[model samples]
Target: MTASHELRLITLYAICARLFFITLIVSASLLPPFDSSHKTILPAADPRSLFDVFVGSLLRWDEFYFADASRNGYQYEHEWAFFPGPSWARRLVRSVWSTGGRRTISSLSEALFTGALTNCLTVWSARILYLISVECTGSASVARISALLSLLPSSPAVIFHVGYTEPLFNLCSYMGMLNCMNAKWAQASFYFMLANSFRSNGVLLAGFFLWGLIADPFLRKQKIPLLNCLKSILYAAITIAPFVYHQFTAWVTFCQDDGLSVEWCKRFPPLIYSHVQATYWNVGFLRYWTPSQIPNFLICSPPLLLLFWSSTDVISRLFRSHTQSGLAKQASMVLPHMVPHAIHAFVLTSWILVAAHTQIILRLASSMPFLYWSAARLILEQPKLGAWWVGWSVTWGCISSILWAVFLPPA
Candidate 1:
């Protein structure tokens, strides 16, 4: 089938599958949660109404924080852990649907409005990812397969049904990569900046700008030009501007009022994101390596392993000659364009493993299209293992939706 045909089919499948998954989660949310006593800002007790069952089902765990931020700005220090992109985006989207004269009326609830925005963004992201895969792999078949596999993400709840950052993040990240592939450096930097506004790790996306405008030419034995060097720095800085601005805002808000009283403000380059993650979430290097968190480690291992394997498989093949006519010859497919993405996945996976919350890889992994490529590769080369991967994604995605509804661990 053509790419357009595949996108239409994917759109249908995504809607149906997302509805099914939400049905299960909402059904479970109708029941009492597994633990009604979640620490750190979870709403106590079960959702009390039909509307609550639908919206509140997905609003468990950290979503409570997002819901709060949607109604209110970043008033609390811990609320700074979440970027303002989703909240701000939701407000913009809701305004489009607002009615009654001066457009002061909200036609929808916060959860409903956010879901409408994300549902469209996610389906559109699927198509963008398909195009990017085609650009990266030079094969419609690989792109189609990768796009299909991406529908069954390890964290379906975050992608389709929630007020989470990842849906917008995925769209922007894919757009940035696609723009970079097309040599649209300015547009690429803009999209990456939008991505960083959603997730703090989005600052790492500047590597794509650096790689495309700078590193790629150096690797090809081209003499470096001063113009390219200046362009690379400018674009990469644009991509990272959101993160730097985010920290600067926090400093302005907190440090100005209390200054040295805030412990994080006392340090050099006092970033509230880093401080909150470390102090509130215990997310420093090896801080999450406790025996009590073993289950979370196991839960997140599949994607982590897949990500590492995918990057290393491409990177290792870089050193080998591909003139021989066999698998070795095929190993170098789109190697140059993929170099940045593979490195991105590898470095980001390592960062998640060592320093960040390991379980978050399930949600964050979807932002990197390379993960789907790796899964596609497995299905093509090792059908048995790929079947297992598919089974695990479907099964665990359903289970996680339930866990989210009930407010269980691995948050």
Candidate 2:
């Protein structure tokens, strides 16, 4: 089959695979002792009907927070921890079908709609990921593998079709990366802004943009005027303006509480979000270190190791290679490309190492496309083991989804 045909087939297969996995999670939720009492946010009581079991099963840990916050607005202090992006996006989406302009909807229905929207976004993300991999590696098979692995039973996969920010975040950030790969700086900046609105890590894309300008020979050769360069920098700052605006919102909220004086409020950086994260969730670099969190740390270590290993290997080649021809030259050319991946992986891994909830690394790591790219490369190098790799990946993904559905550990 032609490459385009192959890509289409893979896209179809990914959609089917996602559907099958979601069905399994729904089935698992209907089994014995299927309790919904443990849910923190979504309205799940006894699954008196099939609808309750299916809808209730999907609203796990963070979904409740998003759903409740979207439906009610940030009513409590802890609610401030969530970025306004996903919650507002969910409401905006739900409003499209509303008879009038109403954004409010029942919590359960909102959860279901948001979950479905997330799944759709994930499918689109897989398509973009496939295109990026093909563009970068010139190997359609590797690109296919990368896209498939992204949808495999990774923790992020569980959130792919759930009511979470990842699907939207992935779509926007991957789009930004794709634009960067094409050297469309302006378009990339737009998507990067959308991404930052969804998650704080969206700011990381700024590094990607800077690296492209510095490393890409074609960009450098253009030797654009200084005024245009400054304009580009100004646009990039504008893209991140939403985040700066949110900090102002947080500061205003803090000031209204009256616990802090006006002088301190003016002096303090937007400590509201950081305070909530540290106090309510025990989140900070290395602040969560304890013997109890060892299992989570261990569970998340493999991906971390793979990312860092790939990054180190690439960096070593860039530094140590002396040859100016053939494979060494090709590696040297790719070295600049690897710069973004190394930086992204290191910063994310550092967050996990310093933070208490290492389990979150599974979800947060979804934004780092290099991880999937590395997995695809490994599969390509071991062609004979590809089948086994796919099997293990899909099976593990299903197991993880089941665990998530049942509200089990290591979510």
Candidate 3:
């Protein structure tokens, strides 16, 4: 079959899988959320109309933070922890959809619209993932499998459909990688900038692209002008400048309010997000050594191990390809293009070990494209297991979704 035909098939499969997953996600909202007697959890939006079932279900957990940030800027210090991209995107959408009126859109309406909008973007993101897999492996079947793998409703799966930053971040990240693969460095830099603005992980993603530009002969061999290179650098620098601004903001805010000296404020910077996380969220580097953190790590290890294995192969091939001549060198670079996934997975794992909550690893793992790619490679190698894999994955997704809907441990 032609590549276009194969791509069409993959697109159709992705659409169907997304519809199925979304249906379950919306339906799951009908099930009552687990009682939160002791935990200081945010209250979910009340499902007033039919639309609530679709959007209301996703307003739990960190959704509140994003919603609050969007409605009221970074009024509270803890609110700065959010990157603001997702919330800003939602506010933009709400503004465009709103008719001229004195009253602003209700927070409920804003949250609902944000959830629906992000979820729709996720469908397109899956299409991009399929395209990337096809570009890398040149196997339509692998592409299909990779796209299907994205449908699994892991613990943080709801984040994609909610007001959280993951959907926007994931979309921009995938687009950046796609542009990078096509050697559209400026475009890739732009998307990466947006991705970086959405989440702190974008910094690591920028580094990953830098690695590609430096290590890949194909990229370096391009006879680009100095001006273009400088442009790329400018875009990248602007992307990272936000974090620096946040740090500066923290210092100014603290010094003005606490009556501290400029010198003392410089030491604090604007790392209030980090401080809040450490003090309130109990997050610190290498902080997951406690017995309670064991389950979170164990549950997420399978995908992380797969990611590590995939990354190791890339690192090995990166070296091996350097020694080869002609086409062999190019082929080796193809595998190493996936090295970013490994780096992302590594960062998340390291964060889990040292600083953040262990459960977050589950959500973060969904960002690793190699996890899906590696799964596709395994299933395609043993074609007989394909159906079984789908069945098991869907079954697991259903159980996890149910548990997550009830606010229970799902990893």
Quote the positional error of residue 344 for candidate 3 in Å.
4.5
Per-model C-alpha RMSD: 3.4, 3.5, 4.1
TM-score: which candidate is best?
1
Predicted candidate 3 versus true structure: per-residue lDDT over 1-411, tens digit per residue? 776776576567656765666677777767776754212322454455556556556656666677667767778756767776766686787677675764676666676677667767777777788888877777777777787787663335666666677777888888887887787877887888888778876776665545555444454465555565565566567657656666666666776855454343445343666766766767776776788768777766656565666666665565566666432454522464565565666666666656777666567666666667877766766565545545655776676666656667652
Off by over 4 Å in 1: 35-52, 97-108, 156-159, 321-334
Tell me the lDDT of candidate 2.
0.71
lDDT of 2 by residue, 110-216 (tens): 77777787788888888888887777766677777788788773454578878788888888888888888888888989988888888876766777755666434
**Which ten-residue region of model 3 has the weakest summed lDDT?**
36-45
Off by over 4 Å in 2: 32-48, 100-104, 215-232, 256-268, 321-328, 332-336, 382-392
lDDT (C-alpha, whole model) for all candidates: 0.79, 0.71, 0.66
TM-score of each: 0.91, 0.87, 0.83
Query: Which is the better candidate, 1 or 3, if ranked by lDDT?
Result: 1
User: What is the C-alpha lDDT profile of model 1 across 304-370, one tens digit per residue?
Assistant: 9998988987776654533233222445354567878999999999999999889989889999999
**Model 2 Cα displacement at 54 (Å)?**
1.1
Model 2 clashing residue pairs (backbone): 153-397, 285-354, 286-354, 288-356
